[model samples]
Target: MIKSLDIVSDLGEGFGSYQIADDDSLLQIVSSANIACGFHAGDPRTMASTVQKCIANNVAIGAHPSFPDRVGFGRRGMDLSALEVETDMLYQIGALNGFAQAFGTKLQHVTPHGKLGNYVVEDSKYANAVAEAIAKFDDSLIIVTLPGELAEAAKKKGLRIAYTIFADRAYNTDGSLVSRNQPGAVLHDIDLITSRVLRMVNEGKVTSITGQDITVKGSSLLLHGDTAGSVQMATKIRDSLIANGIIIKSLNATK
Candidate 1:
């Protein structure tokens, strides 16, 4: 039986005046926060403020890095050399580290954002580059990724892994996330999502888009703040998980 799980959400994903989620409300609900590091969707001000919130609330903070694409929201894949990917990871992680240090708190983990995140599962070069970069920068920084090349590369690099699943996203039969372009790729119904998460939490499995059962490990569950009713969904999910006997603990706190 699963004793504990981390409830994490993407925070600080806004740039300038454009905001995405209710960071304040979600901060109160989530155990860990994957904050954007200014590449995909956050600016310096946003990152600093988000880190402060995490520190004030005692929520674990993780750096969320992505390709240097702002228009596509880092959802568009970029063709870059392994060195470029590694350096980009280092840059983003370092940027977040500065604010964390100023706030007297260190980042607990690193998770790639958007397309950079999805490619890490199938692209070994990309996955290894990201893993190597994080390990080089700070081996203590946990890597939150699915059970695939990313996790494997991080393991080989002697970094801790926090396997996660998308509570609001669908999965493919091959254990990859269903593309956002696909129909039903993102779930919206609150009751449905809550029930699906409960099963994934307790059974360590989820039904894929092709109607196949795929094994999933959820040391952390990823919730999206950009989605409709996300705050409500997160609150309900956290409450439901506890009601079902699962403890909501950050990955940094769990063994």
Candidate 2:
């Protein structure tokens, strides 16, 4: 039986006056806030404001770094060398850390965003670069990644880790997320999503797109804030998980 789970979502994904999701609502529901670090979607002002909100709500703050592609929202792939990836991660993490310090808090973890995040799961170069950067910056910071190469790299680098899983996205048979470009890759039905969350948390398993059962030993589950009806879905997931006797808490919560 699952005793607890940490629900996380991407926040601070806005620039100046343009906002992507209703962050205020999502922050109340999620235990962790993966704030954008100005590489993909946030500006300096946005980052500071978001950090303040996280502090206000007592939510754990995380740095969501990505390839420097604001126009593509960091969803597009880039051919960056290991050195480039390391520098990008360091720059973004440091920027957010500064804001966190100003707000009287500190970053609890680092989760790569979009394409950079996906590549870290399989590409050794990218995974090692990210792990090395985090280790060099602050070895105490948790490196959030899937249960694969990225996790291994972080372990080798002597960094703490938190395993992550997606609640609304379909996974391939190999435990990888289905491509967003594919049809039915992103789930919307509240009932379906809640059911999957229960299985993932309780049984430590999730059904893949090909109908294969895959092991998903995740301590944290991600609900994308940019998805339509995301806030409502997050609420439902949280309520149902609590009703089932699973404690909703942040991974960084005091043990």
For all candidates, what are the clash counts? 0, 0
Across residues 132-234, which tens digit of lDDT does each residue of candidate 2 receive? 9999999999988888889999888778899998999999988899989999899999999999999998888999998889988888899999899999999
How would you encode candidate 1's per-residue C-alpha lDDT over 81-130 as one tens digit per residue? 99999999999999999999998999999999999999998899999999
Candidate 2 accuracy as TM-score: 0.98
lDDT of each: 0.92, 0.93
Candidate 2 at 200: error in angstroms? 0.6
Each candidate structure's TM-score, on Cα atoms with residue i matched to residue i, is 0.98, 0.98
CA RMSD of each candidate after superposition: 1.2, 0.9
TM-score of 1: 0.98
Q: What's the residue-level lDDT of 208 in candidate 1? A: 93
> Residue 63 in model 1: shift from native, Å?
0.4
Screening candidate 1 with a backbone cut-off below 3 angstroms (N, C-alpha, C), the clashing residue pairs are none
